[model samples]
Target chain A: MERLNRKERVAAILKILSDNPNKVISLSFFQENFSMARSTLSEDVTILKKVVEDIGVGSVETVAGPTGGVRFVPSLREEDRQSFLKELCESLKNKDRIMPGGFLYTNDLIFSPEITNKLGIIFASYFRDKEPDYVLTVETKGIPIAMMTARYLNVPLVIVRRENKGAEGPTVSINYVSGSKRQIQTMSLPKRAVKKGSKVVFIDDFMRAGGTAKGIIKLMEEFESKVVGVGVFIEAKTEKKLVQDYISLLILNNVDEEREIIDVKLKNN
Target chain B: MERLNRKERVAAILKILSDNPNKVISLSFFQENFSMARSTLSEDVTILKKVVEDIGVGSVETVAGPTGGVRFVPSLREEDRQSFLKELCESLKNKDRIMPGGFLYTNDLIFSPEITNKLGIIFASYFRDKEPDYVLTVETKGIPIAMMTARYLNVPLVIVRRENKGAEGPTVSINYVSGSKRQIQTMSLPKRAVKKGSKVVFIDDFMRAGGTAKGIIKLMEEFESKVVGVGVFIEAKTEKKLVQDYISLLILNNVDEEREIIDVKLKNN
Candidate 1:
């Protein structure tokens, strides 16, 4: 490859780092690929660090010593985060979203790539400090957001299935009570999904009574792993929650089916 | 924000464009945010286009008209895509991934964020020209990759569920035979998930006899939508497939459970 000038070098470097979020790239990689001196590449990285921060999209961090390199840590600006959540809440307030039994229809929003991508960045910002080995979620509704969180954190995503499949080989299945439905539900995972003594963060689309969150805690224990953090897109107001200490972007106060009204608000706004 | 010089402007533009893949950003956006003149921002974008292409990451395109703007079209270099698929085939060759019933235990790999992110980019590259309105997939395993594909294409992801949920409101459910198992199965989707005359691309993790893909086509027909493209991570060797004209990354020849061997190879390599 031909050597690039400072302008080209900075753009190339930023693109590579942003592509592999939170995963460090050795200095030698840039040196070998761009055929530039160490000092020159260092200057390009320093310039990139300021450029990214100036844009308020993320930060480019430089690690020190052996095995150290630079990585891009994605984050949303505080005001941007708040306004995004506000807009999300407004979207959820549509009366048409209220279904039978007062259930809120959120598949269109939660399954959106653009929204989930931002949600992933926000969730990663909150849990990245925990240095989780994996991002975990139950199958179906939560996979998209959890997958995004895992991508931003540069970690593998482990999905717990609703039922054990023959394709999963030997599995660990556990029955837990659903706080909202008050019924026994089963969740399963492959035995080799996570390493023992590893840390994982749980991400989901909704939290109603927090029964699923509590069940996740028990499921992690069976693997000798830990759930260090939990994040949800929406949390319904209930008299009592099965678990506490979880972050939610939106709060669902009421979904009146007969009245044809939906009331949702941004959490902590 | 203060005016940034050429190097800083180039970096910022690339970062923003990459963040919102396939979404056009008007020049006024940069003019307002970076406090730059139109000519200056245009020059920076020209340089960024060459830099990204030279690095073999993707291309930056400028749309000309009243609502003209620039957008990033992401693509993996041919060699990189081939090598990535080769490594994936190698990973699948692990004997431990074989289950008792000749099923491959691929939950770990298919659920991986890094792997699926790349797979999404590749799928988007192939189908982007179709200008899909939505990227569709079945529940459980296909959500992650489909979400990524939708992200890269800047479209909403629509997931088909195995069973209808009350929260989805009125849904359209259909029963189809599992091509491999030869048993009847059901798939459901919200009635409003797709607009009439919209084009969609189907993505999934594996295809045994293409029964599910065929089911997607029939389901889309109910909404008056069209299935423009189909992509999968792996395609198992079958006597005959139920669908044709689809792209697959890998081909599975055989899984010898008794001999503890797995035979897989890159598709069209």
Candidate 2:
């Protein structure tokens, strides 16, 4: 195996901390596994502390107690976190990643290390920024992106099933208009999935009419938690007013099924 | 703007070449634009030549005439290309990136800079292996990833539409079973979109039934081209056998709508 450099080593360490959320690990644990010296490990951790501040709600708290060593408490600047995530969205904005209907292909981007790495960084950044209690999205397609986002944020991403999730018992549902369906569809979020006052970021793959995003907004109201922000792969710019404080990698302004014209451009990071 | 290292500089040059698909730029143009010395420019060109080769295409080439400096012929290796993309995929696989329904959120991953660097590297690696002749996908959701894949391979992504595109004249469409609908839906491709004998890599956000992939397959058949492979973000394993010879980053096997049981695991690169 190849040895890691200081930066790669530090990145790896922070990633490790970020991975095992809500846990404190001894610096010695990393030192032993990496076969790195204590001083070097300490320096690595220091670098991690500094870099993570830019992108992760991530902090390395050194514990002097018997059980404490270093604990990562997610926290970071929203600008830094947004910048961190903007990179992933931009990469997906590449024309090559563009799929039909001017959609940005999250499936392919997630499979790529570069895109996924940014995904982790973005999530870690969010963890530092919003400390969202949970992640939220609509079903099927939104599942993957929401999972990834939640994983990074070290929170669970809950889905609002458009279709009945039989196991959730009698569910709470609301009807909202979908641009695709051009009508109302029943959208549901599990009761008690999120507590009141909890913060959340809503994520979905493609937002056309944004009926789904709005539905989730109503669902969040039921929990009394704030919708921290909204994120999407492809935003149908026509629905710009669907939500305030939203981010999208690519905005689909014009998609003509007859003309076959797809106008795609990068959105604010 | 900050000055870049040799690797980033070289990658930037390749991007310049690919973006100008319709025209060829002489070395002098690059030299004048970057304000670099001749020897440095030559070395950069050499590195770029190798990068194009690594992406599995000969699209980048050198013209011998005085007016000729360098050009991209767009040839590459398919297998190496997809593997190159593994880096981004692996990065996205971080548990932190998981949101809900075994889904991964990649908006930030696609937009961030440092993460985009990793994404660029992963994409370059995948393109080096994939060397596809054309990028393919269904409209709307798959665009971003497919566009990125198409870009790394230095090829144009041809979308298969589910509805008619008026500008393209009469569209060609086929019916296939959708895992989402469990019923046949009409899908299409432009008549002149792809040439015969072309090699294509099918890409999308999520794969449930493989029906969409199969639809792309049938659409490509209209042009008598071969479907090289399918790449996706999250594969609901239960829906496997929807298409053969496909790859994905995550596998979601146990989906229990009632219990909210969603098990996601990373796929081998």
In order, candidate lDDTs are 0.91, 0.60
Q: Runs in model 2 with CA error above 4 Å?
A: A1-26, A47-128, A138-172, A178-185, A188-198, A204-212, A221-226, A231-269, B1-130, B133-172, B177-183, B188-198, B202-213, B223-225, B230-269
lDDT of 2: 0.60
Using lDDT, give the best candidate's number. Answer: 1
Alpha-carbon runs more than 4 Å astray in model 1: none
* Cα lDDT tens digits for candidate 2, B1-269: 13444443454455456434323578888776566787997877766554444333445566777777776543324454455455555565555544455444454443222232233323434444556777777754454455455545556656666666443434587887886658979986656567788888887767887888888887788878888778776677773466767877567665454454445666776
Q: How well does candidate 1 score on lDDT at residue A73?
A: 97
- CA error at residue A76 for candidate 2, angstroms: 13
Error of 1 at A255 (Å): 1.7
Error of 1 at B84 (Å): 0.4
Could you tell me every candidate's TM-score relative to the true structure? Answer: 0.98, 0.47
Q: First chain TM-score in every candidate?
A: 0.98, 0.67
